[model samples]
Target chain A: MPPRPNQCSQLSGDDYAESGRRAPAVQIDDVVVEKGRVRILDGISFTIPAGSITGLLGPSGSGKTTLMRTIVGVQAVRSGTVNVLGRTAGSAALRSSVGYVTQAPSVYGDLTVRENANYFATVLGRGRAEAERAIADVNLTHEADRLVGRMSGGQRSRASLACALLAKPELLVLDEPTVGQDPVLRRELWSQFRALADAGTTVLVSSHVMDEAARCDRLLLVRDGALLAEGTPAALCAAARTNDFEDVFLRLIDAADQKAAA
Target chain B: MLLVVPSSLLTLVYSMFHNQPGRFDHIGLTLLAVFPFLTMFLITSVSMLRERTSGTLERLFTLPIGKLDLIVGYATAFSGAAILQAGIAGLVAYQLLGLDTAGSPALVVIIALSTAILGVACGLLCSAFARTEFQAVQFLPVVVLPQLLLCGLFVPIDGMATWLGHVADVLPLTHAVSALDAVGSSSDPTAAMWQDLGIVLAFAVGALAAGAATLRRRAA
Candidate 1:
């Protein structure tokens, strides 16, 4: 059985030295990433607290994906530092500790869902029980024996998610995971993310949808390769003087544009 | 099927065109050099490119596996097909076609296997430059066709212009064809045959190193 929400924190705290304050799960200090001549992420800095669900909210082409990639240690940066799980991002030591799910489904099409999960689990030094539990966690038990190629688009994405979940990674980076999912499934997945956070996992999920912003414990609002705002959902909404989160987000972007114009 | 069918058809056509009693040796040598090389190159390139375009390669890189492990895994997996292909094509060209060669038949099979493995190495290097399967296929003209035209399977390098002969000397398939020719016409493998084999193996290793250097965790 999985540990309860409160017990999970103590479990993780024992592994690292918690002198007086716990270190953040992720720390980025003025990270700048460039692709060719275009700056994909411009001087971004933020710290993601351990065991929390942090939403990376931004418009399309606003560098949300690039930020996630940097955290996962896959995206090359032109400058700055990205520390994940107390180590440098993309270090060999973090390979098994970090789980990343891309926008597109990333499982082998020729393999059955179970086989895909098992293969990744074994790569991470986990066993079959973990693979099966991960399959069940994603609610893909029914499709376990089916080839990923024959599954529906949503099913395939969930299969990819299951593979990532196999190792119970300390840091999970998901890029637009709920894009095409149905309302009920999205709610369930969001709850799952919450449950994982409660169980001492740091989940950094990126989404363009404003409605999902409320579900995150903390939100990082990004626009034009720069961070526009970072705070709790209620604080941001109150600061923008709007109850509707979408309106608050638009107002922030408008404010940023006007500031730049001035 | 990839090697046997094309080689049998080519041998049949060549024999029909020549209509000579001792022409099977020429047919056998051509089949040994061209069939395995072409098939492995086309198949490996497209399949490996599909892994890139489908995003599997990106996920695989995130795993604990190293880049060299992935490249060698691909090479080893395809080499199984290459082995079977060389064996079948060699048997069909030698026994079924009644091709008579002065050299040891085992030497011809060895050349065919080397050429197939070489094809796999070159395919992997070329796959790094292609984004889609169609782009992988486009490399056929720029990469494989020139080697076919200059490899001395259809025309002797000696009969070509000096510059063209020089160009042929640089291609892996040219060395492969020369080795096949040397083994087909002599009782023992010549020094030139050994040198050409060494050159073909060098090309395979060099391309593999380049492929490893060029592999990216994600498509740019």
Candidate 2:
């Protein structure tokens, strides 16, 4: 069972998960992000432990994507620090150690799958064999020679993932990675996630999928840039005294809304 | 695929001045005659415009690569065909025109390459300021066309509208044409060519800095 936010805090950071360091792989301390004068991430703070799988669960417009971009150094932190891999997100070494798979597939439409992979490898300093292995890992080897534009949506997502994994990053951030994937493929991908965590790679995934939220080692429930609740799916359910993660997710969202209104 | 821009430049030069234009005067004047610089402008600016239009600019910002690498990579990649076009133009000029060739042929090739770089730099600066490919293209007549019209190519530099002539004197290509004209005539190489090279380098560096700033703003 997952611990309540406060309860989880009590469990010495190391005891919370298999993650090695007490310091987080990603740490956001009082981050406030804005886009064109509109606040997107409003003084939010959280720490994702190394080697743990942390799922960011939120309703739409909850600033999930904004937060993820901040962690990857693409979005500026209006105020506060974002530390990843023991350095600021903007640090070159940290950039190399962190791989990001954005919501949109970043593959070039005109390039073949293999060409796309090769381009990434060349730019990211990955070896050919490693790139091929990543393709194989994502089960994209069969589609390697096909143009990215012609591939199915799910295959494009898989190719995007393979490209992200090519760098063999220690901290991987995936935003709604399984969006267009089939149920079986989702299951297979989560299994791969588990393997990645087992190998000591910290993973941060953002998703609205409730069942998927239940599978993550921990969850950060957010709404309107504020942390609504933080715990494992089971712990949240226990706190709400319900077995359903969806119900727990909803109740917390409602509670946060009510509090904000008051 | 990306070779279209350079090939067009070569074709424009060939179509305009039929029968090989020999001698530096004929080749240089002929190149200056057609609007080849416009093609170079489009080639250098279009790629950056495409990146922004396709949402790939944001994607590129998320990568680990340095800003310098991005600038240099795109510039170097586009330079290959630009050099090829210059070579073909020179060869065609040699065969078609009966101008006597003097001095190291390699020096001419170097000058041609430097000129291409100047053109690319100008295009890059335009791309830096433009939000879309169309906006960049609009700059063609206002920015590049004047360089051709007033840079002492067709009309003597002294004969143009006084202010236009002054503006043309400051143009980067004006110095380049001065150098080429001198080289073609096998006369004393004017200091104007060195000045043109210096000005082109300045423009290239300024454009690169502007590009880096734009990229930084986007990332932020």
Chain B TM-scores per candidate, in order, are 0.93, 0.80
Model 2: per-residue Cα lDDT over A114-135, one tens digit each: 8888888888877889889989
TM-score of each: 0.91, 0.86
Off by over 4 Å in 1: A1-21, B1-18, B217-220
lDDT of 1 by residue, A179-261 (tens): 88898899899999988987888899998877787777778999878899987776677678776777878899898889999
Interface RMSD of 1: 2.0
**What is the fnat score of candidate 2?**
0.36
lDDT of 1 by residue, B1-220 (tens): 6746765676675568566766657755766777777888898899888777777777777778789888888888787888877777777777777777778888887888888888888888899899888899998889899999999867889999999999999999999888888887899889999999999988988988998888866433
> Judged by DockQ cut-offs, is candidate 1 incorrect, acceptable, medium or high?
medium
Q: Score residue A173 of candidate 2 by CA lDDT.
A: 89
DockQ of each candidate's interface versus the true one? 0.51, 0.34
Deviating ranges (above 4 Å) for candidate 2: A1-16, A20-22, B1-37, B52-63, B96-108
lDDT (Cα) of model 2 = 0.73
Model number with the top DockQ: 1
Q: State the weakest 10-residue window (summed lDDT) of model 1 chain B.
A: B6-15
- C-alpha lDDT (0 to 100) for residue B26 of candidate 1: 74
| Candidate 1 chain A lDDT trough over 10 residues, lowest sum | A6-15
Checking candidate 1 for backbone clashes, the offending pairs are none
